[model samples]
Target: MTETPQRPLRVLAAMSGGVDSAVAAARAAEAGHDVTGVHLALSANPQSFRTGARGCCTIEDSRDARRAADVIGIPFYVWDLADRFREDVVEDFIAEYEAGRTPNPCLRCNEKIKFAALLDKALALGFDAVCTGHYAKVVVGEDGNRELHRASDMAKDQSYVLGVLDEKQLAHALFPLGDTVTTKDEIRAEAERRGLAVARKPDSHDICFIADGDTQGFLAGRLGKAEGDIVDESGTRLGTHEGAYGFTIGQRKGLRIGTPAPDGKPRYVLDISPVTNTVTVGPAAALDVVGLTAIKPRWCGTAPTGPGTYTAQLRAHGGETEATAEPVDGELRVTFTEPVRGVAPGQAIVLYDGTRVVGSATIATTTRATAGAL
Candidate 1:
């Protein structure tokens, strides 16, 4: 007697028209999942090619995604998420920057759009899960609870950005690229072997809305020019700047200050005051943070039972340091064993227990050692 084939899963694969996403969709279909590739039309006005190879969602990218879906033997559709993208990702990004905070739009998109919006729609439409090419893993515990973990390829791990996903989101998420310990080149080669047109598409980087990678210009266009003073940590005026939104923490160059410091040492941007519209330049030591407080913390599974040590990463692709994390009134406070630098408010502080992602939160404030205290 012949054995019956296993039934396919009803999957909605999000194809970003890149090699990674194309290969991911192909793999999903190859695994006998009833996969349907969907490209998100994020940009309201998408060009054929974006400037500086840092942009995506152009007409070419959508076409390439559709072609890849055809090669993978799956149905393809373009989902118009431009309005949602603008409201959730683009406008929120501008608002965060205007408030003198460093915001990660990629993380915001993953949190609000991909996993939240897309996943919700997929579930409503009877899809089992929303698949993506992100380099992160979703595992099931012995108790059947979903767990989010780092990718096997440590070099390409994207668990930092995905820390915002809660257990519900992780339950309906599938990452085909996370299980393998292969490099990105291997994925592209697989796409090529499968006759996918996006096998060699350039990787999208930088903020997608800012086509030329000129974030300052993009913000200036939306928010008209505003003059502000560039001052030292002591409140002494060093120079004047066009806008404070253009600056970020730890920025050294482009201060446009004619006067040098008394010590002739290079100064870095220590603080940005949206209230006073002042950009503060100071010594690099001022950027060192001994501790931080984060609000609206989201645990991937269960909140920590008690205070303990965890590895905290302040930025994407940044180094992690062992820190003591305590839950305080629905917020999290982390004290690093060793002081970290360039930690910006509004950025995510992802906590990890070994390789498993414990939780994440948006930094609200940083604590610095006083000069006299040291």
Candidate 2:
């Protein structure tokens, strides 16, 4: 498993037709790996899959990947991963919303599709490893455990989307874009130089599976229109919402509450209760949380058993917050060293030990610690 495995490492690049994966395939081939390109057709997603050179999944991106494979003198193929995407990503997303929880679909996709399904397929095909453009690094420890780490390119670092990948996946994963000088701008320039059609295309933003980023609209369209009441923390009727699934924690806009609070400050969605079919609203400060409890955690390498602390990031762009995490009663008790703001439920809280990614979990809920809620 050491010593670079072997030359001409049978590498399969999960090409997304983006500049990064395009360049990744080329580099793997240049490095003498038996490189091939695989584009996943996520047609089940009810969005415009018109991805550019910057976004991951789209028709244009697939073409670019194929073109790159051609340029790199490798076979190219597109697998119909639409069913898998629907069952694993789209269904999970809908279910999460239904349960009044926010979800990271990208993380689910990586967990179920790329690292889980694709990795399995690669192993079956006898390919040494499957590679991608994820801006993360996989290092195999001397103990044979695989560790995940942030890429040198911090801005484009995709460790958040990769948090669900466990040790087994990381061990067989390759990130050619881990250490690179290719910024988004630089990648586009290189693609243009290589005459890729997607080089000039604008990048995709927002959720890809949900078209137009109208999450509410998408939920209504998919999850059947259900009316619900918006209430305060004490269960007093405040207003009515379209559905409980439409609102999320820390959301301040589009409350549609006709009555204004006495303080005149806009109320934020503190939480949603699907069982009660109610949405709770309060001042902005109510969203602040002191700690969280995460179940079914996935460590990049292996879960540590100690009162160790690490940098816990709540959002992708969110700043680091210190947290003491320990396995308690089968859940990760993450008590933030400092009170954290907008600690939303159903979001991913990625834990890192310096540069290495320790683990991540979908935030189930947070409770005010003995120190009190943040």
Question: Best candidate, TM-score-wise?
Answer: 1
Residues 69-123 of candidate 1: C-alpha lDDT, one tens digit per residue:
8888899999989899989999999999899999999999999889988999999
Q: Specify the highest-lDDT model's number.
A: 1
How high is the lDDT of residue 141 in model 2? 63
- lDDT for 10 in candidate 1 is 89
Q: How well does candidate 1 score on lDDT at residue 266? A: 93
Each model's number of backbone clashes? 0, 0
The digit string of per-residue lDDT tens for model 2 on 343-365 reads 76788988999978998887877
Query: All predictions: root-mean-square deviation over Cα?
Result: 3.6, 2.7
Predicted candidate 1, C-alpha RMSD: 3.6
- The CA-based lDDT of model 1 is what? 0.85
Give the TM-score comparing model 1 with the true structure, all chains together: 0.95
Task: In model 1, state the lDDT of residue 254.
Answer: 94
> What residue pairs clash in candidate 2, if any at all?
none
Clashes of 1: 0
Model 2: per-residue Cα lDDT at residue 354: 91
